[model samples]
Target: MSATRSAPVFAINHMVTPALRPQAFFQLARSLGLQDVEIRNDLAGNAIVDGTPAADIRAQAAETGVKIATINALQRFNEWTPEREKEAIELADYARDAGAAALVLVPVNDGTGRQDGERQNNLRKALTALLPVLNERGLKGFVEPLGFEICSLRSKREAVEAIEAIGGQDTFRIVHDTFHHHLAGEPELFPQWTGLVHISGVTDVAVSIGDMRDSHRVLVNAQDRLGNIAQIRKLLAEGYTGLFSFEPFAEEVHQLENPAAALSQSIVLIKSQLQA
Candidate 1:
């Protein structure tokens, strides 16, 4: 591997510290030596969902000098509806004002939108609807296909095709989530088309891959069964130099008394694996 392709750049998502205030999350990112971070709107009672002013988020991020990579996502993004359009517009505006680099677009994972002939139409409609909104705000739309069987969009291949079909390669990019990718059993990596990579690991020896859920996610380590290191190595070796945002969803990670130390240890382990 080339020296330039050695270790990936690291980032953290608000999910890692779902309980922290937005300002504190920014401070945490800076203190961890991570230059980039992602925020979320789903955290109950949090700033975004609670309607904290976007100006506040922007100011806090500026003070900490940590770039807000994205808002965790616009859930069920592909199921276009008047409500979803309104939601997208609201998020796009926030993303613009908050200085967020992109707006993550997560597909419908409710197990209801995958019916015959509905999936493709929903995806195309969502992309077409979102292209202009993101373009207007000068924000990239990071479309993430969940790996779950019920997820309407399960493959990056399909996401990329939809993006291309809509001539949205410039306005939209795929989020190659390591955990989701493994879950979906994807055989190919769209390294060049990927704009972000969410990293998490599953270390439970007894948990089967099919039974894995976000709650099972935790920081990467020697016991990780998700092949995070290997997947990262594939992306880096293919010249995908983008943010690797930590997104462990397990309660253990969220409840950690010193998440910073635990995060640093995971980062060290991942980096060492890449260099090796």
Candidate 2:
């Protein structure tokens, strides 16, 4: 892929305030000259449901030229019971109509401290059940294996295994997150699974992976990149041809005096780093 061929898509999760209206979010992306945005469903006031009429989202996309790269998440879909399964299917349909290219699925962080075998088995079952729904919708299911110590699936290896077990490699792909990859203590794991990348940086290692919340994520730079550039280089070298989205979750970014300028600067910085 050319340096700009796989132009990075950015997520509004780091820039838009949850309280802001969707129109304002798209406008922000437009001002940044961004053509893609990832929408997180659980953000307060941003709970996008099936009831959220499609016309509104479609209009925003049309006006801004910002396409929905992926719906933020369908959490623990791997462990959903029959009732939850229906709810997820409804959300998948909503995402399709909203013009989203994929649904990002984060594995369940079941707090009960189950044994490793049991957790893996539940994950396989969940992915198996969710695959057909995704296939029917023609939507890619981007599985994001979070790396917090408590998270059930912490690496791409496990995600690949789960997808393979469920025969979902055709419809499902991995979401390689820089922050999560660093937290997972696996710096060079991207080559095995080529898919979407969620990029961000963290500064503090003293902060335990479990204790470090999303607020700590920031843009990549020498002072605080936490090896994100190295990670991206590895992915590019490995022939990844998918989107790389900035998904910082920091309140500082959202509260910036000029978010568009910040986003533009961040994108430039990312481009420079990738080219370097």
Candidate 2 segments exceeding 4 Å error: 1-17, 47-51, 204-210
Q: Which pairs in model 2 have colliding backbones?
A: 78-126
Best by lDDT: 1
Per-model TM values vs. the true structure = 0.97, 0.88
Give the alpha carbon lDDT tens digit for every residue of 56-126 in model 1. 99999999899999987899999899999999999999999999989999988888889757898889999
Give the runs in model 1 whose Cα sits over 4 Å from its true position.
Answer: 1-4
Q: Candidate 2 residues 95-176, lDDT tens each?
A: 8888888898887675543468877787788888888898889899888888777777777887788889878878888888
Model 2 TM-score, 2 decimals: 0.88
Model 1 C-alpha RMSD to native: 1.5
